[model samples]
Target: MTLKATKTWFLRLLPVVLFFICYYCSQIYFDSYGSSGKSPKTTVSLCDINSSQRKWSSLHLNTSRHPELFLKLEDFFWREHLSNHSLPYGIKGSELLLLKVLAVVTSYSMPGNVESSLDCRTCVVIGNSFTVKNSSLGEIINKYNVVIRLNDAPVRGFEEDVGNKTTLRLFYPESASYNPGKHNDPDTLLVLVPFKQQDLLWLKEILYNEKRVRKGFWKPPPQIWLGRFSQIRVLDPYFLHLTASNLLKIPLNPRRQQKPVHPTTGILAVFVALNYCDVVHLAGFGYPENRNQQQPIHYYGQDTMKSMKNSFHDLNLEARVLKRLEEQGVILHLHS
Candidate 1:
């Protein structure tokens, strides 16, 4: 070949080679830092890439295999039967009313399997404990594949400590946020943990925009819930049963004298995450170390530990179970 011809061929191939090199580098970059140059909002992190082989605790293995996370049409009759027997801390709504609400909300039921592009699915349960107020865990909490917040914990101004990314916010009617939009993302699932027949009634009224009921709830629920119906999910009563009976060792049907112990939203949220996540984490849990400590129970509210005396939850027992979970490698606590 002529020298001039050889030079022409080299020049033609140079552009093509450079294009391939740039494309390959770009792919590598996105894989590491994601498309937006940050950890992905809902996928395995680099540190947890190989976490699939890790052995989960017995608590996770026992409950994770169950397919139903939320109440569905199929379980209506069974739930109704259980409710008729005076089951404590379980939904006692009429079968007809319960069926109607389940039909609307269960359409958005969680998938039986954990959905993730990668093997390791990370989750964080953000509690309302005041300990998280200055923990500076916002960036860390936001990195998980799932961020589950409990009750009415506000995330607007506390984003610096409690990341604003919430995949699920679990609450009963009494604890539901008045302004859910300010605390939840556009796609956050509003999971209702019904403690009584009235709770389901309240949800039905809220979803259908029926006349608001000012009675039944210990405290008044939101008069108008602005969230979309598709964003709602009713937690399966089985979780409430499991958390109360197995985890907390509380009786399903307490006698009249026993002030009716039930699982708190924080611990219940952790149980939900265990079923759907590979590595579960907890933030802002634990109560004031002592009765006289004068520490606020919640991050945003001025209410202190004294307020817990009137509550149905036994916070001391919940704290112990959480500690055991941390020790067993089932979950990691984010706050000191």
Candidate 2:
């Protein structure tokens, strides 16, 4: 045969030859080892060391066969430990002993596994709505270590808004008012949740109103508000206080600040509490969970017509997020 013809014949047989070589190598590997050299899974399995000695030998085989397999397995387990949900501290004012017992029971009983420790607990309560007024949520609200409130959240006529308690009050400078009387105390934990870039200017305008300050509406100066909170903390603005899915970005509704005003701020506070707190009991947040529940969904002093419709949406969001976190063993939702 000519050289060209011979080359063609070799090319046609090359694939078949390579296939057999691979097949033979695989057979040799399996027959000599008797098992694949892979690490065991995390699940517990029953086995007798004596009876399964041969099986173990085959499974381990030569270290060279699965070089980093053991290390990789260890890494996997370590990741799980790092991601495991564990709260070291109790909610807040409640006795740590109460949480310790509950933590022990819930860790094993809950659907998802949780680390047994009360040290990781954190609670953030967010709404600035008038809904909390006079409902007597203050004593309960004070139980949380971290309390986050939004713009113009005051405890004056709306006793529930202030809850007679506040750890952190986040608001735009513009929304803060000192007209008739200072709604919040100088000692109150105040945070500035900025909105429009211009809103900061508006905040400054309100806070820095020398006239208002002299009128006794603001006992502490504008510089004083910043000075006081600066000593405490400035939490990241986007640090959601709850479980919000990153799967989809919630679009900002045009009328969000207008009608159907669902309070993302309120929902976020509860969400944060779920991730970090062990036993989360809500207050002032109305009963949209069941229509038959005695309490109305909103705090009393609200513009009943406008706030009622919007408040329901916010309440629903809270209920849904609470349900999901409960399933994850992150929190025990106390729905009253």
Candidate 3:
């Protein structure tokens, strides 16, 4: 081709070259920016893909008759409460043996009850969904007696959308991180959801980093270490299973009930909040599919901009459950 022909071709591809240059530079810039800078270290390619597809047998959901299901059980994490009667599924033999030993090291301690418990109480469960962005719910959210936030959704920067007061923060080993200075509140209780014995093992490591301990089910990166948290509590597996079956209406396998879906942290938080407070409120939950299916998954990270749904947690169905409770005056469904 002649020089004139080559010049014309270069002009046509100029925008394409500039676009690639900008995209590459942005990735480099964002990759090293801040704490929400890089995605939480995970075995999965991404952090949100942390759900395990364990083939659990179906569990019955005939729990509406039991009002006591919401209250704390006796000797919760102290004993391996692995009996199938306590839970629909029995703890596997090896995990049972491990947790039985783990129980020796574990102790249950509740956060000292404040005067607020005796007062007329209202609690709110805040999720990390992007729907709450630009929502002026901060002032109203703070008015509640208790506010529970999930994982590492920061309030310092995004206080307007999510409230500043964090009474409780619920998370698990995979999703939880220890940032020393950010959430330095003695009042905020950090609750751990021990999905398995490995979770307990993992917590032992994070809280009190030991060398040459027996192997646990979960093996996160060696660099995983926790900062100071004022209070820490392990959730009894029975409580989560109870939530999955009863409040969520998940039925036993081979029965005409909702599938025994694993309750997400948000689902568990909703249950926990409802029991403690006279009325509960839920914010930033149930992926807003109608408005924007392509919005960022969490308020903190803008990397994964897409819908939040998975086979493991039926968030939509969970949302429906919350709505039903709202109609029954059990809770208030705070929407964006």
The lDDT values for all models are 0.76, 0.38, 0.58
User: In model 1, what lDDT does residue 74 have?
Assistant: 78
Candidate 3 residues 1-336, lDDT tens each?
A: 999999999999999999999999998876665335233121112111111111001112343222122113244433434445332222333344334433443434444453323434556789887678888788778776668888667788787777788777877665666562475355676776666555656666555555525454343433454544335655555667668667776653434454445677888887776545554567887565645656666767773434334345677788787777665655555654
Model 1 lDDT at residue 192: 83
**Which ten contiguous residues of candidate 2 have the minimum total lDDT?**
64-73
TM-score of each: 0.79, 0.41, 0.64
Ranking by TM-score: 1, 3, 2
lDDT of 3 at 7: 98
Candidate with maximal TM-score: 1
Residue-level lDDT tens digits of model 1 in 109-208: 6532335354667888998888898888898888887889988889889988998898888988888987788888887888888778778888888877
Which candidate ranks first by lDDT, i.e. highest? 1
| Model 2 agreement with the true structure over 1-336: per-residue lDDT tens digits | 999999999999999999999999998976655444221110112223333333223322231111110112123222322332111111112223222322322121111112244343234464543345445555445545445565555566654334454544545334444431255544454443333333333333343442332222222323324333121222222332112322112323435465422335455455434333433444444344344344343454333333344242445555565565446543433221
Query: Lowest lDDT 10-mer window, candidate 3?
Result: 49-58
